[model samples]
Target: MSASTKPIGSARGPAGPLESRPVEDSGRRGLTDRVYEEIKALVMDHGIEPGARVGIESLARRLEVSPTPVREALARLESDGLVTKRSQAGYRATELLSVEGLVDLFDMRRLLEPRAAALAAVHATDEQLDHLETTVEGMRSHPVTGERYLVYRRFAALDQEFHDTLAAASGRPLLAQAVQRLHTHLHMFRLNTAPGDALTTVDEHDRVLRAVLRRNPDRAAEAMEQHLSGSWERHIAVMDGNPAKK
Candidate 1:
């Protein structure tokens, strides 16, 4: 899609138009955040195709923002693994993870996330638990199908939020940061446009949430481990030319 065709401060995915924070109502930091979010949506929706060079001035013109905020947003996106900067080459959207990269990502997640779930089970506040439940419900609301990434962006976003929230609830800031740095959902969602296992994913999340809600660290860890293993298998199947069942 042409950058000029997209409206400033708004992004469209297959589901609908994603709302943006008004740049005029916020301070510098808020403006940067808005720019960051809009750019992220554009990248996620493939409006800015993967590996395409991102022109700061062009993006600024497209979003009707100054280059400052666009620069700041691109820096943040680089950290999020959604974009990358090259020496003397400026910024470009990062390519989707390879099969080997996916394997490595899941290996690290298997080590970290199960522990995070265990810790969250023991240390999470009631409010955090409530939020987790609400997020899962939100996922339920956005069922996945044989559609493009834009069509299931809400599900993808909620999936990220659920994991991020669980990681933070572990009461381990460093661990939470590590999990966030992985950007697992973003990379995985970008890996395949048609995700067919929405119901299975939601059910797996429900299992993890239930164990955490019950304050069962072992069970929570086990549930998380199972979920990750299952997820890895599902993605592997997709990569192998077979989509997982819905």
Candidate 2:
């Protein structure tokens, strides 16, 4: 049976249904950055299909920004692996991850994240643990609602912050950098989402957080491995003979 199909540890199963609210942007970022994030959101929410052309003029008109910022935003997205630039065709939304790419991504994550978790258990300060707690709280505070797209967006950001904090807690800059480069959670959101998936994710995170709080390196590593492995299986199951399926 698939790992995702297997029950997550009984202690860390899904909680009650999530009741998410619309994700609120604080409007703190500069215009260029905001434009970049908005366009990126369009791609991630599948508002723009994989491999479809991204017309800068149209985007600029919609966003009410100059074409310069739109072009700049596309260039930045290209670096994030979400946009691709064809030699003569300008930019298009990048294709979703292939099965092989998914395997490779999880493989690299398996190698790096567990080690980071183990180190985090050994080195995390009280302040770092509190920061981790804050991120998890954010996830739990917003339950899934009718705003599925917004729910996914909020969950993905919180998830990224959670992992990024965990990696930083390792006190090894290079190791943390490696984990950040994977962009595991961001890409995973691009794959598929089911109703209970967010709750399951929070439960899995709680396990890791508990282990870390106890400063148990072995348990922390084990929990991290299970989390990543479960995520892999869930994403793989959503593949309907394509990189991603709605």
Candidate 3:
């Protein structure tokens, strides 16, 4: 992605200047929410490059809104870990995860997720198992082909939901919260545009779900480990500039 920090408002689309889009409501909160989604999309889509400074006034001008809403949006983004505030400089998009960061992230996952899956095998309610089945089925419909993030955004969302539901079903609130805080799917999707191994991902999720549905703790744990290992390899391949094998 380009490191240039261009004004978001300068780009015109089929509709018009993004700033020219209408807000749904006249309420202050509504305006702020709209601004938040707009800016969030920019950040997520890398319209603003990683580690690039975000100018409040420029964004406000581009969005055709006051600085107040932009500031509010930035604060919310900060909580989401998409941006960071500096002491005196300003806000900047969070940098892409480094190789070491990726390793640490997977370390945490391997520590928590397999255990969570094992617990889920013993503790998941019928509803939660159904939800997992539904989510995996949903994923199968969203066939990912190219390297565009937008193309596989739905798959990414469902993938997150599958892991999250499994964690929640472990009957451990702390574990679920910890996994959510990692924001694993968001960071992984943001790491690069390559939608790594969608078909293989679906198959892996199916294996994990089947094990959980059968209430086999050892099997579930094993499946989860394999899934994470495969996922880590795919991401590492992307980072090394190789197309992940499907």
Each model's TM-score, in the order given? Answer: 0.80, 0.81, 0.84
Q: What is the lDDT of residue 81 in candidate 3?
A: 85
Ranking by TM-score: 3, 2, 1
TM-score of 2: 0.81
Considering lDDT, which of the candidate structures 2 and 3 is the better prediction for this target?
Answer: 3
Candidate 3 backbone collisions, by pair = none
Worst 10 residues of 2 by lDDT: 3-12
Query: Given candidate 3, what's the lDDT at residue 182?
Result: 89
Candidate 3 residue-wise lDDT at 85: 99
List the candidate 1 regions with Cα displacement exceeding 4 Å.
1-34, 145-150, 242-246
Off by over 4 Å in 2: 1-29, 86-89, 146-148, 240-246
| TM-score computed on alpha carbons, candidate 1 | 0.80
Whole-model lDDT per candidate: 0.82, 0.76, 0.82
**Residue 23 of model 1, lDDT score:** 51
Residue 207, model 3: lDDT of 98
Roughly what TM-score does model 3 have, to 2 decimal places? 0.84
